[model samples]
Target: MEFLEAFFGVIGDLTWGWALIPFLVVIGVFFTVVSGFVQLQYFGRMFRVLSSKNQSGDPNAISARAALLLSVGGRVGGGNIAGVAVAISLGGPGAIFWMWAIALVGMATSLIECSLAQLFKRSEGDGTYRGGPARSIIHGLGADYRWLAIIYSVCLIASFAFGFNAFQGNTVAGAAEESLGISRIWTGILLTGVTGLIVFGGIQRIAKVADVIVPIMAVGYIAMSLVVIALNITEVPGLIYSIVTNAFGFEEVVGGGMGAALAQGLRRGLFSNEAGLGSAPNVAATADVRHPISQGITQSFSVFIDTMIICTCTAFIILLSDVYQPGAEGVDGIVLTQQSLASHLGGWTSYFLTGAILLFAFSSIIYNYYLGENALTFMTSSPLALQGLRIAVMALVFIGATAPSATSVFFFSDPMMGILAVVNLLALMMLFPTAKRILNDFRAQIKAGVDRPVLNPDQFPDLDLDRTAWTGKIRENG
Candidate 1:
């Protein structure tokens, strides 16, 4: 395990350097521009679609709100809180600016990939939706790319099972031990039990739990952090100043210089939203909205809420509390976050943070399982294969609980996510035209006084809807 981890670490570092970051940026930027910045144009529509309840006869995958809830459940987790702390500790408060920048582009990336996923999502015998790069690769790029899709599936499954799920569990246990006196074993047992109960219930169950819990936990944490900021309101401007100026290396931050700040910021931001990494789109494709782009727009807002709103709140809590001065040794991971909050809210805050971490970790475990399950379906449709995969996933969740080192959690996670991002970005580039056409048509209809948004893949003669269109659009204005 040591040898393998080291190898993955080296590879991950090499890819994570200038090569992958620029590649992700370029692809995201291209799509953002190509779609005429749909993230901005249709931003209001996202809320409208998410807020509206679906009628009983909607033939879509899941309710728009449910899909948003699930996607929110997946992205808004330990990464937002703990990961933000790690960014500040390693890269300084300056990292927060770059995180916001990445998320800005990441929203565009989310829109593109999610639209593509909807284009090719499958309706299984169980009456649920499953899609991602694997489905898009096969549907758009043809069978020749099926091999590429298989490789992607294997890597995605490995990422979620060994990297994401394990890391989420370990973070919960680590936070518990550091903040409270609980052992990792006890933490893992509690988490594993919670995960088992929710995961077995599938998307509807997961979404229901998320719809209630995600908003409450997120708003609660942010509210506490807001009080902390109010207590130290004087420092807010300086913190913002530090984040923006330091983003371009105008001022020296932690480690050597600007490079460290950029790396730390991008790493934390990417992990927080999992935008270009392609994981969210798996859940996004399952939405019950009338059009894939509708769900796509809603999900784009989710990325913003996860990284910009929630993660930023956590960052402000830490910086405002002044937990780390320039010359002081930094706190690590969730412990640092717990300490920061404790400073504002006292010891009881630590226990609440621990519980929040557990919720974050548990929801992520179920979501990670869904991603892996979809990947398995992309590779093979065999029921036995799926059954075996479920059992294996559950067993790994148990294994994740017992893993002692957070370092090991990161070692497994970083590389697999990098690989998944590369594959997803590649698919997004190929399907950009489809995304563009849909955005244009949707916006044009709204401009022409069409109250309802209709996107029929079959109606588009020039574009092969079968290849890239997800939902059947309304035939006429009612």
Candidate 2:
């Protein structure tokens, strides 16, 4: 186990530090430029789309808003909390600035990939739609690129189910043990059991659950964070100053200099908001939006909320407390946030955040499970295979809970996430021409005074897409 962890850690470090970082930044910048800064162009429209109805009246099809919530729930987890702590501990306050930078670019990257996913989405013929980078690759690019799609699916499964979900379980277990004195093994078992119950119920059920949980937990956490920040409001100006300075101030940072800040910020930011990593599109495609851009723009908001709002909240929570030393390399992950919150509020805040961790991490576990399950469908449709995967997911949750460290889980996940981002970004680049056309069609209609713009299949005759999905119509449900 130690050897595997060490080996993967080295590979993960190399992948993110050397290959993926620059690649992510360049591609994200490219997408942002080519999309005409769509993230900003449609920033107001993002809110407007959230109020629109689902085009498909099919009972099983999710609304764009539900998809947004699920994506947010998936995004808001150990990564937002523990990952942010880890970044600050290892990189310094400057890492927060880098995280903001990545999200700025990632917002556009997400818009492009998710919009393409909807354009190339497939109807499951069971009142469901599905798509992602893999769907975009195979359908948009053709059979010759089927191999690439398969590889994307494999890496997504590895990242979400095997790697990301384990980290979720590990964080939850660690928090439970530290705060409430629960045995890690017992925490693991309880988590696995609860996870199994939800995952087996399928994505629709998961969406319903997310609709309720995501808003509640997110608001609760943010409200608590607001209290902490308000109590220490005077320190915020200096906190922001340090975040800027340590981002470039070599002498004040614990983790050496700008190098650590950039790496951890990009890696952890990608993990948290997931703008370009290609996981959210799976759920985004499931939304029966009138136009692909509707979901795409709304999905971009997830990155803003995850990194800019939620992650920044966690950072403020930590930095506002006396427990956090700017130059000292102390705790990371849930423990640091929990302890810091406790210091600011009271000892009870530790237990409060333990519940937050459970909810946050559990949402991600199921979200990752669904992504893995979605990926497996590209490989095989066998019930037995999916069952086997569920078993493995459960087992992994247990192992992560009982494991002594999250290092192995995180190390393995980092490389897998880098791989997913690489493949998905490549596919997005290849499919950009088609994506541009699809997005343009939406822009033209909206500018022409169409209150609720929809995709017209006839307009996109050259592209092969599910007619059911691009019907150029929306049902007005009063």
Candidate 3:
């Protein structure tokens, strides 16, 4: 067991260490520049597109709002709460500054990758749209790179479906056990049943559930944080100053140096928002929109909500309370967060946090399943194979909840996610020219005074796309 832990530990460090971190940052920055800072240029358009009605009448398609919620379900999870506390514990308050930095650049990366997903999206026989990093690679990069697609699909399945579900289950079970005095076994059983019921209904069920739950939980948690910040309004200026100064090594409140602070911030930020990691594009491809860039802009807003709004709320709650002992032992992860909240609001808030975590974790479990299901469909269209995968995922969720420790799970999943990021980043870089062209085309239409940009596939004859997908546009001739 020790040997296994050590093996995964080394792999996690190497995969997420200096080499890959710089690569991710550079790609994010490169896309931001090449796309003419689309994140900034289209910031308002993101909200406009997200709130607009579905432009396609495809029954299997979802509204842009539904797609955004589904991606939000995946992006805003334990990472927003527990993960933020862990970052501050190791990196100090300054880490929040870097989190903001990565999120800004990552918006551009999200725009490019998600737009590509829409461009290469294929329709299943059932009318549902299917696309993501794997489909993007196969369609955008050509048949020769199918091997890379297969590799990405396999890693994505392992990371999100099996590994991430287990992690979420463990978190919920632990919170329940600690706060509610519930047995892990019972928690696991109940969670497994709930997960099975929703997942069996498929992506539409997941999307509907996310639409209702994500807003409540996110808003409720943020509202709580807002109250805390409101009460401590006087400390806001100093808190902001500390985050900035410590980020640049000007302050040494925490024991670790500036390098550790930067590394931890970037790692946790990427884990939370997952902008360049190629995960959200799976859901982004399912949106029914007039232009591919519409969904891309909508998803860029998701990154902001996840890292900036939700994650910042968590950071503020911790930083505002006195429970955040940067160099202290036994204060980390979810416990650190709960303690910080209780410090300000009283012990009853611990129960409130458990409920919040349950909602957050449950949404993430279903979102993770959809990602794996998409990968499975890409690999093979066999229903039996998918059923087998579903059963396996449910069983893993139960085991993860009842398991005593999640150390091994984190160690194993970290490297798998790293591989997914590397493969998807390479594909995005290769397909950037096509994505850039689509962006330019969308901009041209907007410049022509079109209220909602409509794509014309006839303009890009060389690209492989489903013609019918864009036929629903409200053109002047129609």
What candidate 2 gets wrong by more than 4 Å, as runs, is: 1-14, 49-57, 248-251, 403-411
Q: Which candidate number has the best TM-score?
A: 3
**What TM-score would candidate 2 get against the native?**
0.93
- Per-residue lDDT of 122-210 in model 3, one digit per residue for the tens? 87657568899999999888899999999999999998999999888888898899889999999999999989998899877888899
TM-score of 1: 0.91
Clashing pairs in 2: 94-247
- Candidate 1 has an lDDT of 0.76
Candidate 3: regions farther than 4 A off: 1-11, 49-59, 406-410, 475-478
Write one digit per residue (lDDT tens) for candidate 1, span 377-401: 7777798987787676666666666
Report the lDDT tens digits of candidate 2 across residue range 38-141: 99988887775445444346678777777888889998987788889889888888899999999999999888888888888888877678888888888889
Per-model TM-score, in order, reads 0.91, 0.93, 0.95
> Stretches of candidate 1 above 4 Å error?
1-3, 54-61, 125-127, 253-255, 327-330, 403-412, 461-478
What's the TM for model 3?
0.95
